[model samples]
Target: MADSVGFIYTFFLTAAVIYVSAIVIIFGVKEQPIRSKEAKRVSYSRKDVLIHIFKQPLLVVTMLLTFITQVGNFSIQPLLALYIHDLHGPVNLAFYAGLAFSATGLGNLLFTRKWGDLGDRIGHDKVLLALLILSSILFIPQAMADSYVMLVIFRFLYGMALGGIIPCTTAYIRIKAPASMQGEVLGYNVSFRFLGNVVGPVIGGIVASHYGIPAVFYVTAGIFLFGALFLWAVRSHAKTNERSV
Candidate 1:
Protein backbone atom coordinates (compact mmCIF):
# COMPACT_ATOMS: atom_id res chain seq x y z
CA MET A 1 0.00 0.00 0.00
CA ALA A 2 2.77 2.39 0.84
CA ASP A 3 4.56 1.51 -2.38
CA SER A 4 1.41 2.10 -4.43
CA VAL A 5 0.52 5.32 -2.61
CA GLY A 6 4.11 6.56 -2.10
CA PHE A 7 5.73 6.26 1.34
CA ILE A 8 5.82 10.01 1.96
CA TYR A 9 2.18 10.37 1.12
CA THR A 10 1.27 7.40 3.31
CA PHE A 11 3.07 8.98 6.23
CA PHE A 12 1.15 12.22 5.85
CA LEU A 13 -2.10 10.24 5.43
CA THR A 14 -1.46 8.37 8.64
CA ALA A 15 -0.66 11.61 10.46
CA ALA A 16 -3.88 13.08 9.19
CA VAL A 17 -5.81 10.08 10.49
CA ILE A 18 -4.23 10.45 13.91
CA TYR A 19 -4.92 14.18 13.98
CA VAL A 20 -8.54 13.56 13.06
CA SER A 21 -8.80 10.90 15.74
CA ALA A 22 -7.43 13.31 18.29
CA ILE A 23 -9.87 16.00 17.18
CA VAL A 24 -12.75 13.54 17.53
CA ILE A 25 -11.59 12.56 21.00
CA ILE A 26 -11.22 16.15 22.12
CA PHE A 27 -14.52 17.23 20.69
CA GLY A 28 -16.66 14.11 20.84
CA VAL A 29 -15.69 12.12 23.88
CA LYS A 30 -16.98 13.25 27.27
CA GLU A 31 -14.72 12.44 30.16
CA GLN A 32 -16.16 11.86 33.62
CA PRO A 33 -14.89 13.81 36.63
CA ILE A 34 -12.23 12.33 38.85
CA ARG A 35 -13.04 12.31 42.53
CA SER A 36 -11.55 11.40 45.92
CA LYS A 37 -7.80 10.66 46.09
CA GLU A 38 -6.95 12.25 42.74
CA ALA A 39 -9.09 15.38 42.51
CA LYS A 40 -8.48 16.50 46.10
CA ARG A 41 -4.80 16.97 45.33
CA VAL A 42 -2.83 18.47 42.47
CA SER A 43 -1.11 15.18 41.68
CA TYR A 44 0.39 12.40 43.69
CA SER A 45 4.13 12.81 44.02
CA ARG A 46 6.24 10.16 42.31
CA LYS A 47 7.18 8.64 45.63
CA ASP A 48 3.59 8.55 46.83
CA VAL A 49 2.38 6.97 43.63
CA LEU A 50 5.12 4.34 43.80
CA ILE A 51 4.21 3.58 47.40
CA HIS A 52 0.55 3.20 46.56
CA ILE A 53 1.32 0.98 43.55
CA PHE A 54 3.53 -1.32 45.58
CA LYS A 55 0.99 -1.55 48.38
CA GLN A 56 -1.50 -3.31 46.12
CA PRO A 57 -0.10 -6.81 45.64
CA LEU A 58 -2.53 -7.72 42.85
CA LEU A 59 -1.89 -4.58 40.87
CA VAL A 60 1.84 -4.93 41.30
CA VAL A 61 1.72 -8.52 40.10
CA THR A 62 -0.52 -7.65 37.17
CA MET A 63 1.86 -4.90 36.09
CA LEU A 64 4.71 -7.33 36.32
CA LEU A 65 2.71 -9.79 34.20
CA THR A 66 2.10 -7.11 31.60
CA PHE A 67 5.82 -6.45 31.42
CA ILE A 68 6.72 -10.11 31.05
CA THR A 69 4.02 -10.67 28.43
CA GLN A 70 5.37 -7.85 26.29
CA VAL A 71 8.86 -9.16 26.77
CA GLY A 72 7.77 -12.39 25.12
CA ASN A 73 5.95 -10.53 22.37
CA PHE A 74 8.79 -8.17 21.58
CA SER A 75 11.43 -10.87 21.82
CA ILE A 76 9.90 -12.93 19.02
CA GLN A 77 8.71 -10.15 16.73
CA PRO A 78 12.02 -8.45 16.04
CA LEU A 79 13.47 -11.70 14.71
CA LEU A 80 10.40 -13.09 12.97
CA ALA A 81 11.97 -12.80 9.52
CA LEU A 82 14.98 -14.82 10.58
CA TYR A 83 12.71 -17.46 12.08
CA ILE A 84 10.88 -17.79 8.77
CA HIS A 85 14.14 -18.41 6.94
CA ASP A 86 15.17 -21.06 9.45
CA LEU A 87 11.85 -22.79 8.94
CA HIS A 88 12.62 -23.14 5.20
CA GLY A 89 9.62 -20.97 4.43
CA PRO A 90 8.54 -19.70 1.02
CA VAL A 91 10.93 -17.89 -1.26
CA ASN A 92 9.27 -14.64 -0.32
CA LEU A 93 9.77 -15.50 3.34
CA ALA A 94 10.62 -11.90 4.13
CA PHE A 95 7.17 -10.95 2.97
CA TYR A 96 5.90 -13.99 4.82
CA ALA A 97 7.38 -12.59 8.00
CA GLY A 98 5.32 -9.46 7.55
CA LEU A 99 2.31 -11.67 6.92
CA ALA A 100 3.07 -13.60 10.09
CA PHE A 101 3.15 -10.31 11.95
CA SER A 102 -0.19 -9.26 10.51
CA ALA A 103 -1.67 -12.65 11.38
CA THR A 104 -1.32 -11.94 15.07
CA GLY A 105 -2.95 -8.55 14.62
CA LEU A 106 -5.82 -10.08 12.71
CA GLY A 107 -6.32 -12.62 15.46
CA ASN A 108 -6.35 -9.84 18.00
CA LEU A 109 -8.95 -7.98 16.00
CA LEU A 110 -11.14 -11.07 15.76
CA PHE A 111 -10.89 -12.40 19.30
CA THR A 112 -10.08 -9.56 21.70
CA ARG A 113 -13.73 -8.86 22.42
CA LYS A 114 -14.53 -12.54 22.83
CA TRP A 115 -11.75 -12.86 25.38
CA GLY A 116 -13.05 -9.81 27.24
CA ASP A 117 -16.55 -11.26 27.22
CA LEU A 118 -15.19 -14.54 28.55
CA GLY A 119 -13.32 -12.72 31.25
CA ASP A 120 -16.54 -11.00 32.22
CA ARG A 121 -18.32 -14.37 32.44
CA ILE A 122 -15.63 -16.26 34.32
CA GLY A 123 -13.24 -13.89 36.03
CA HIS A 124 -10.43 -11.72 34.77
CA ASP A 125 -7.90 -13.65 36.85
CA LYS A 126 -8.89 -16.96 35.28
CA VAL A 127 -8.95 -15.32 31.89
CA LEU A 128 -5.47 -14.04 32.51
CA LEU A 129 -4.32 -17.50 33.51
CA ALA A 130 -5.76 -19.04 30.38
CA LEU A 131 -4.24 -16.44 28.07
CA LEU A 132 -0.79 -16.72 29.63
CA ILE A 133 -0.70 -20.50 29.61
CA LEU A 134 -2.02 -20.73 26.10
CA SER A 135 0.51 -18.14 25.00
CA SER A 136 3.29 -20.14 26.64
CA ILE A 137 2.27 -23.31 24.83
CA LEU A 138 1.88 -21.49 21.53
CA PHE A 139 5.51 -20.43 21.64
CA ILE A 140 6.73 -24.01 21.60
CA PRO A 141 4.95 -24.75 18.35
CA GLN A 142 6.27 -21.54 16.86
CA ALA A 143 9.75 -22.61 17.83
CA MET A 144 9.11 -25.93 16.12
CA ALA A 145 7.46 -24.48 13.04
CA ASP A 146 8.41 -26.23 9.81
CA SER A 147 6.98 -23.54 7.57
CA TYR A 148 6.16 -19.85 7.63
CA VAL A 149 2.47 -20.63 7.36
CA MET A 150 2.58 -22.69 10.52
CA LEU A 151 4.41 -19.95 12.35
CA VAL A 152 1.95 -17.35 11.12
CA ILE A 153 -0.92 -19.47 12.38
CA PHE A 154 0.74 -19.76 15.78
CA ARG A 155 1.36 -16.03 15.87
CA PHE A 156 -2.32 -15.41 15.16
CA LEU A 157 -3.39 -17.72 17.97
CA TYR A 158 -0.90 -16.09 20.29
CA GLY A 159 -2.26 -12.68 19.34
CA MET A 160 -5.75 -13.85 20.19
CA ALA A 161 -4.38 -14.68 23.64
CA LEU A 162 -2.57 -11.36 23.87
CA GLY A 163 -5.59 -9.24 23.03
CA GLY A 164 -7.46 -9.98 26.24
CA ILE A 165 -4.65 -9.09 28.63
CA ILE A 166 -4.90 -5.29 28.55
CA PRO A 167 -8.66 -5.34 28.93
CA CYS A 168 -8.49 -7.79 31.82
CA THR A 169 -5.90 -5.76 33.66
CA THR A 170 -7.82 -2.53 33.06
CA ALA A 171 -11.04 -4.08 34.33
CA TYR A 172 -9.25 -5.54 37.32
CA ILE A 173 -7.83 -2.15 38.29
CA ARG A 174 -11.20 -0.46 37.94
CA ILE A 175 -12.81 -2.98 40.27
CA LYS A 176 -9.96 -3.06 42.80
CA ALA A 177 -8.75 0.53 43.06
CA PRO A 178 -10.32 3.85 43.95
CA ALA A 179 -11.03 6.03 40.93
CA SER A 180 -8.25 8.46 41.75
CA MET A 181 -5.70 5.69 42.12
CA GLN A 182 -6.95 3.89 39.04
CA GLY A 183 -5.53 6.44 36.61
CA GLU A 184 -2.10 6.49 38.21
CA VAL A 185 -2.04 2.74 38.63
CA LEU A 186 -2.92 2.29 35.01
CA GLY A 187 -0.23 4.79 34.15
CA TYR A 188 2.27 2.59 35.95
CA ASN A 189 0.91 -0.40 34.06
CA VAL A 190 1.63 1.36 30.76
CA SER A 191 5.06 2.29 32.03
CA PHE A 192 5.74 -1.35 32.77
CA ARG A 193 4.67 -2.22 29.23
CA PHE A 194 7.02 0.38 27.78
CA LEU A 195 9.82 -0.95 29.96
CA GLY A 196 9.19 -4.44 28.63
CA ASN A 197 9.20 -3.15 25.08
CA VAL A 198 12.63 -1.68 25.69
CA VAL A 199 14.02 -4.79 27.38
CA GLY A 200 12.42 -7.61 25.39
CA PRO A 201 14.18 -7.01 22.09
CA VAL A 202 17.58 -6.77 23.76
CA ILE A 203 16.98 -9.99 25.62
CA GLY A 204 15.69 -11.66 22.49
CA GLY A 205 18.69 -10.54 20.45
CA ILE A 206 21.07 -11.75 23.11
CA VAL A 207 19.42 -15.14 23.36
CA ALA A 208 19.35 -15.48 19.58
CA SER A 209 23.02 -14.54 19.26
CA HIS A 210 24.09 -17.05 21.91
CA TYR A 211 21.62 -19.92 21.57
CA GLY A 212 19.94 -19.58 18.14
CA ILE A 213 16.60 -18.07 17.12
CA PRO A 214 14.55 -21.09 18.24
CA ALA A 215 15.96 -20.70 21.72
CA VAL A 216 14.46 -17.23 21.79
CA PHE A 217 10.99 -18.75 21.43
CA TYR A 218 11.67 -21.24 24.21
CA VAL A 219 12.87 -18.41 26.39
CA THR A 220 9.89 -16.27 25.43
CA ALA A 221 7.57 -19.11 26.40
CA GLY A 222 9.35 -19.38 29.74
CA ILE A 223 8.83 -15.68 30.31
CA PHE A 224 5.10 -16.13 29.77
CA LEU A 225 5.11 -19.08 32.18
CA PHE A 226 6.92 -16.98 34.73
CA GLY A 227 4.17 -14.37 34.43
CA ALA A 228 1.48 -17.03 34.87
CA LEU A 229 3.24 -18.52 37.86
CA PHE A 230 3.83 -15.16 39.43
CA LEU A 231 0.21 -14.08 39.00
CA TRP A 232 -1.02 -17.45 40.32
CA ALA A 233 1.15 -17.23 43.40
CA VAL A 234 0.03 -13.68 44.10
CA ARG A 235 -3.60 -14.67 43.71
CA SER A 236 -3.08 -17.66 46.00
CA HIS A 237 -1.37 -15.55 48.63
CA ALA A 238 -4.10 -12.93 48.46
CA LYS A 239 -6.73 -15.64 48.86
CA THR A 240 -4.88 -17.14 51.79
CA ASN A 241 -4.60 -13.78 53.45
CA GLU A 242 -8.30 -13.21 53.03
CA ARG A 243 -9.12 -16.60 54.54
CA SER A 244 -6.82 -16.13 57.54
CA VAL A 245 -8.19 -12.68 58.29
Candidate 2:
Protein backbone atom coordinates (compact mmCIF):
# COMPACT_ATOMS: atom_id res chain seq x y z
CA MET A 1 0.00 0.00 0.00
CA ALA A 2 2.81 2.41 0.87
CA ASP A 3 4.56 1.65 -2.41
CA SER A 4 1.36 2.21 -4.40
CA VAL A 5 0.74 5.54 -2.66
CA GLY A 6 4.35 6.59 -3.30
CA PHE A 7 3.99 5.74 -6.97
CA ILE A 8 0.90 7.90 -7.28
CA TYR A 9 2.63 10.79 -5.51
CA THR A 10 5.69 10.42 -7.71
CA PHE A 11 3.53 10.44 -10.87
CA PHE A 12 1.85 13.70 -9.86
CA LEU A 13 5.20 15.27 -8.86
CA THR A 14 6.71 14.33 -12.22
CA ALA A 15 3.75 15.84 -14.09
CA ALA A 16 4.02 19.04 -12.10
CA VAL A 17 7.74 19.31 -12.78
CA ILE A 18 7.23 18.74 -16.52
CA TYR A 19 4.48 21.40 -16.66
CA VAL A 20 6.60 23.96 -14.80
CA SER A 21 9.67 23.22 -16.90
CA ALA A 22 7.70 23.70 -20.12
CA ILE A 23 6.32 27.02 -18.92
CA VAL A 24 9.77 28.23 -17.89
CA ILE A 25 11.31 27.20 -21.20
CA ILE A 26 8.55 28.85 -23.20
CA PHE A 27 8.85 32.08 -21.26
CA GLY A 28 12.62 32.08 -21.68
CA VAL A 29 12.22 32.21 -25.47
CA LYS A 30 12.00 35.68 -27.04
CA GLU A 31 8.46 36.91 -27.37
CA GLN A 32 6.95 37.35 -30.86
CA PRO A 33 6.37 40.83 -32.24
CA ILE A 34 2.80 42.16 -32.11
CA ARG A 35 1.68 42.16 -35.75
CA SER A 36 -1.44 44.24 -35.22
CA LYS A 37 -1.30 47.98 -35.77
CA GLU A 38 -0.74 50.24 -32.76
CA ALA A 39 -3.47 52.69 -31.82
CA LYS A 40 -3.15 56.32 -32.95
CA ARG A 41 -3.90 59.29 -30.67
CA VAL A 42 -7.59 59.65 -29.91
CA SER A 43 -9.99 62.09 -28.27
CA TYR A 44 -12.09 59.34 -26.69
CA SER A 45 -12.18 59.25 -22.89
CA ARG A 46 -12.92 56.18 -20.74
CA LYS A 47 -16.52 57.26 -20.33
CA ASP A 48 -16.82 57.74 -24.09
CA VAL A 49 -15.60 54.20 -24.71
CA LEU A 50 -18.11 52.83 -22.19
CA ILE A 51 -20.92 54.78 -23.84
CA HIS A 52 -19.90 53.57 -27.29
CA ILE A 53 -20.06 49.95 -26.22
CA PHE A 54 -23.43 50.41 -24.51
CA LYS A 55 -24.92 52.32 -27.44
CA GLN A 56 -24.42 49.48 -29.90
CA PRO A 57 -27.63 47.44 -29.84
CA LEU A 58 -26.02 44.64 -31.81
CA LEU A 59 -23.16 44.19 -29.34
CA VAL A 60 -25.49 44.22 -26.38
CA VAL A 61 -27.81 41.71 -28.00
CA THR A 62 -24.93 39.42 -28.92
CA MET A 63 -23.60 39.40 -25.39
CA LEU A 64 -27.07 38.77 -23.96
CA LEU A 65 -27.61 35.85 -26.34
CA THR A 66 -24.24 34.35 -25.51
CA PHE A 67 -24.96 34.59 -21.79
CA ILE A 68 -28.37 33.00 -22.15
CA THR A 69 -27.00 30.12 -24.23
CA GLN A 70 -24.22 29.44 -21.73
CA VAL A 71 -26.68 29.41 -18.87
CA GLY A 72 -28.89 26.93 -20.66
CA ASN A 73 -25.93 24.81 -21.72
CA PHE A 74 -24.51 24.15 -18.25
CA SER A 75 -27.73 24.25 -16.22
CA ILE A 76 -28.18 20.48 -16.25
CA GLN A 77 -24.57 19.39 -15.57
CA PRO A 78 -24.75 19.53 -11.80
CA LEU A 79 -27.98 17.53 -11.64
CA LEU A 80 -27.46 15.06 -14.51
CA ALA A 81 -26.32 12.12 -12.42
CA LEU A 82 -29.01 12.58 -9.82
CA TYR A 83 -31.61 12.95 -12.54
CA ILE A 84 -30.57 9.68 -14.19
CA HIS A 85 -30.66 7.85 -10.89
CA ASP A 86 -34.12 9.24 -10.18
CA LEU A 87 -35.30 7.84 -13.51
CA HIS A 88 -34.30 4.35 -12.38
CA GLY A 89 -31.48 3.99 -14.87
CA PRO A 90 -29.49 0.80 -15.47
CA VAL A 91 -27.61 -1.07 -12.74
CA ASN A 92 -24.37 0.53 -13.93
CA LEU A 93 -25.64 3.93 -12.96
CA ALA A 94 -22.23 5.63 -12.68
CA PHE A 95 -21.14 4.47 -16.13
CA TYR A 96 -24.34 5.64 -17.81
CA ALA A 97 -24.18 8.96 -15.98
CA GLY A 98 -20.67 9.49 -17.23
CA LEU A 99 -21.70 8.53 -20.76
CA ALA A 100 -24.63 10.91 -20.68
CA PHE A 101 -22.41 13.71 -19.44
CA SER A 102 -19.73 13.04 -22.06
CA ALA A 103 -22.11 12.61 -24.99
CA THR A 104 -22.76 16.33 -25.20
CA GLY A 105 -19.07 17.11 -25.56
CA LEU A 106 -18.57 14.47 -28.22
CA GLY A 107 -21.52 15.74 -30.22
CA ASN A 108 -20.38 19.35 -29.87
CA LEU A 109 -16.87 18.48 -31.02
CA LEU A 110 -18.19 16.77 -34.12
CA PHE A 111 -20.57 19.55 -35.17
CA THR A 112 -18.77 22.78 -34.23
CA ARG A 113 -16.78 23.35 -37.41
CA LYS A 114 -19.65 22.44 -39.70
CA TRP A 115 -21.94 24.91 -37.94
CA GLY A 116 -19.32 27.63 -38.17
CA ASP A 117 -18.98 27.11 -41.92
CA LEU A 118 -22.74 27.15 -42.33
CA GLY A 119 -22.97 30.42 -40.42
CA ASP A 120 -20.31 31.86 -42.71
CA ARG A 121 -22.36 30.93 -45.78
CA ILE A 122 -25.68 32.14 -44.36
CA GLY A 123 -26.17 35.13 -42.08
CA HIS A 124 -25.26 34.69 -38.42
CA ASP A 125 -28.68 35.81 -37.20
CA LYS A 126 -30.49 33.22 -39.30
CA VAL A 127 -28.18 30.46 -38.10
CA LEU A 128 -28.47 31.61 -34.53
CA LEU A 129 -32.27 31.56 -34.70
CA ALA A 130 -32.33 28.03 -36.07
CA LEU A 131 -29.82 26.67 -33.54
CA LEU A 132 -31.63 28.31 -30.61
CA ILE A 133 -35.00 26.88 -31.62
CA LEU A 134 -33.62 23.43 -32.37
CA SER A 135 -31.71 23.25 -29.09
CA SER A 136 -34.80 24.20 -27.08
CA ILE A 137 -36.88 21.60 -28.88
CA LEU A 138 -34.29 18.89 -28.23
CA PHE A 139 -34.52 19.57 -24.50
CA ILE A 140 -38.12 18.31 -24.45
CA PRO A 141 -37.04 14.69 -24.77
CA GLN A 142 -34.41 15.22 -22.06
CA ALA A 143 -37.04 16.41 -19.61
CA MET A 144 -39.23 13.42 -20.45
CA ALA A 145 -36.45 10.85 -20.69
CA ASP A 146 -37.44 7.44 -19.39
CA SER A 147 -34.02 5.84 -19.62
CA TYR A 148 -30.33 6.75 -19.46
CA VAL A 149 -29.91 6.09 -23.19
CA MET A 150 -32.68 8.48 -24.07
CA LEU A 151 -31.18 11.25 -21.96
CA VAL A 152 -27.77 10.78 -23.52
CA ILE A 153 -29.19 10.83 -27.03
CA PHE A 154 -31.17 14.00 -26.40
CA ARG A 155 -28.25 15.73 -24.74
CA PHE A 156 -26.01 14.77 -27.65
CA LEU A 157 -28.39 16.30 -30.17
CA TYR A 158 -28.75 19.37 -27.96
CA GLY A 159 -24.96 19.74 -27.93
CA MET A 160 -24.78 19.60 -31.73
CA ALA A 161 -27.25 22.46 -31.84
CA LEU A 162 -25.28 24.36 -29.22
CA GLY A 163 -22.00 23.96 -31.11
CA GLY A 164 -22.96 26.70 -33.55
CA ILE A 165 -23.71 29.34 -30.97
CA ILE A 166 -20.29 30.70 -29.99
CA PRO A 167 -18.75 30.72 -33.43
CA CYS A 168 -21.74 32.49 -34.92
CA THR A 169 -21.75 35.00 -32.06
CA THR A 170 -18.07 35.75 -32.49
CA ALA A 171 -18.44 35.97 -36.25
CA TYR A 172 -21.34 38.40 -35.85
CA ILE A 173 -19.35 40.59 -33.48
CA ARG A 174 -16.36 40.69 -35.79
CA ILE A 175 -18.56 41.58 -38.73
CA LYS A 176 -20.32 44.40 -36.84
CA ALA A 177 -17.74 45.92 -34.49
CA PRO A 178 -14.98 48.28 -35.62
CA ALA A 179 -11.57 46.65 -35.88
CA SER A 180 -10.21 48.49 -32.84
CA MET A 181 -13.28 47.71 -30.71
CA GLN A 182 -13.59 44.08 -31.77
CA GLY A 183 -11.22 42.89 -29.05
CA GLU A 184 -13.16 44.78 -26.38
CA VAL A 185 -16.43 43.35 -27.68
CA LEU A 186 -15.00 39.82 -27.54
CA GLY A 187 -13.69 40.42 -24.00
CA TYR A 188 -17.13 41.53 -22.79
CA ASN A 189 -18.72 38.48 -24.47
CA VAL A 190 -16.31 36.18 -22.62
CA SER A 191 -17.04 37.93 -19.32
CA PHE A 192 -20.77 37.42 -19.78
CA ARG A 193 -20.27 33.77 -20.76
CA PHE A 194 -18.27 33.07 -17.58
CA LEU A 195 -20.84 34.92 -15.51
CA GLY A 196 -23.49 32.64 -16.95
CA ASN A 197 -21.36 29.62 -16.09
CA VAL A 198 -21.10 30.76 -12.48
CA VAL A 199 -24.80 31.54 -12.18
CA GLY A 200 -26.12 28.45 -14.01
CA PRO A 201 -24.99 25.78 -11.54
CA VAL A 202 -26.38 27.68 -8.56
CA ILE A 203 -29.73 28.14 -10.23
CA GLY A 204 -29.77 24.52 -11.36
CA GLY A 205 -29.13 23.22 -7.83
CA ILE A 206 -31.90 25.39 -6.39
CA VAL A 207 -34.47 24.42 -9.04
CA ALA A 208 -33.61 20.74 -8.79
CA SER A 209 -33.81 20.74 -5.01
CA HIS A 210 -37.16 22.49 -4.94
CA TYR A 211 -38.88 21.14 -8.06
CA GLY A 212 -37.08 17.87 -8.82
CA ILE A 213 -34.57 17.02 -11.61
CA PRO A 214 -36.98 17.12 -14.55
CA ALA A 215 -38.00 20.65 -13.66
CA VAL A 216 -34.44 21.78 -14.31
CA PHE A 217 -34.64 20.69 -17.96
CA TYR A 218 -38.05 22.28 -18.38
CA VAL A 219 -36.87 25.60 -17.02
CA THR A 220 -33.68 25.51 -19.07
CA ALA A 221 -35.67 24.80 -22.22
CA GLY A 222 -37.96 27.72 -21.46
CA ILE A 223 -34.97 30.00 -21.00
CA PHE A 224 -33.53 28.95 -24.36
CA LEU A 225 -36.90 29.44 -26.03
CA PHE A 226 -37.10 32.90 -24.51
CA GLY A 227 -33.64 33.66 -25.86
CA ALA A 228 -34.79 32.64 -29.32
CA LEU A 229 -37.81 34.92 -29.11
CA PHE A 230 -35.68 37.78 -27.90
CA LEU A 231 -33.23 37.26 -30.75
CA TRP A 232 -36.10 37.24 -33.22
CA ALA A 233 -37.37 40.55 -31.85
CA VAL A 234 -33.93 42.08 -32.11
CA ARG A 235 -33.53 40.88 -35.69
CA SER A 236 -36.93 42.19 -36.62
CA HIS A 237 -36.22 45.54 -35.08
CA ALA A 238 -32.92 45.76 -36.92
CA LYS A 239 -34.68 45.22 -40.23
CA THR A 240 -37.09 48.17 -39.74
CA ASN A 241 -35.71 50.95 -41.96
CA GLU A 242 -38.40 53.54 -41.18
CA ARG A 243 -37.94 55.85 -38.24
CA SER A 244 -41.58 55.23 -37.29
CA VAL A 245 -42.90 51.71 -36.68
Residue-by-residue lDDT tens digits, candidate 2, 17-85? 999999998888787553556333234455665677677676688899999988987788888878888
lDDT of 1 by residue, 1-245 (tens): 35457568878999999999999999999987655655566556677777877887987888888899889899978888877877764576556666888999998899889988998999998999889999999889988888767887888988888889878887887776666566777887888899999999999999999999999999999999889998899999999999999
Q: Give each prediction's root-mean-square deviation over alpha carbons.
A: 2.9, 4.7
Residue pairs clashing in model 1 are none
Which segments of model 1 are wrong by more than 4 Å?
2-16, 27-49, 88-94
TM-scores, each model vs. reference: 0.86, 0.81
Span of 10 residues, lowest total lDDT, candidate 1: 34-43
Count backbone clashes in candidate 2.
Answer: 0
